[model samples]
Target: NQIHSPFWCPTTIETPTKKSEFPVPPCSTPFNHVNSSALSYEAQEVRRCLRQGLIESPEMSHAESLVLAELEDKLRAAVGTRYPQDD
Candidate 1:
């Protein structure tokens, strides 16, 4: 009888011998591009704000807060789809 595992597995078992044995299709979507661009822009803005002294004034603090919040929301939305909702 063969032992089954939900975690570790023996490497001696059946394994693909050729790279082509398992083909992976290219995954590209317009949403991915847009999301990447938005994330990049937000990161740049955050860095710029930090370099200019984010806490120099109340206005700067507010602006930086907004940028950070937007970045956080975008990241959560992007990852939330891959995870189940909490109760």
Candidate 2:
């Protein structure tokens, strides 16, 4: 009922936390942009696995071998083209 209502409600406000600041430092050494050796190593390892898969495909069903072959080809192409060579 309107006769039983309270006159005022208490409220609380939270204080803001201090933020840590960072300043941009001048560039010293040129940052190394690419790691060609690592990329090539990984690609070669994947290629090796794909070759092994091809060899073992004879034990798999015809449809499975076909799918594996298609995937291997796509991955091979991607690895070959995606990385840059060290000049």
Candidate 3:
């Protein structure tokens, strides 16, 4: 019995037939060291959905919401480490 995340919808996975719809952000500093082409298929899918606003939409599934929360926590932690707060 294999378990899968609720966010995994086979119907939603499709090859892009046209030009890449995922737009690169204007500020690329955060992604400078990361290679987009080296990302795994699953990561690419998540990136595509994130760029499309599907991940943050009102209709987002519970699994997506959880994933988003985790991503946010990771981002906060990374930022904190990069620029420590003075208190």
Identify the leading candidate in terms of lDDT. 3
lDDT of each: 0.48, 0.46, 0.50
Mark the regions of model 1 whose C-alpha exceeds 4 Å error after superposition: 1-34, 55-85
Per-residue CA lDDT of model 2 for 3-26, tens digit only, reads 211212112222355333322234
Worst 10 residues of 3 by lDDT: 2-11
Q: Per model, how many backbone clashes are there?
A: 0, 0, 0
lDDT of 1: 0.48
Which of candidates 2 and 3 is the stronger one according to TM-score?
3
The predicted structure with the larger lDDT, 1 or 3, is 3
**What lDDT tens digits, residue by residue, belong to model 1 across residues 3-85?**
22311222123334522122222335454332233344446667777788774443456778789877877887788743454
How far in Å is the alpha carbon of 47 misplaced in model 1? 0.5
Question: What does candidate 3's lDDT look like per residue over 5-82, in tens digits?
Answer: 222322132344532233223444454343343335556667777888784444557788799977877886878744
Q: For residue 56, what is the lDDT in candidate 2?
A: 40
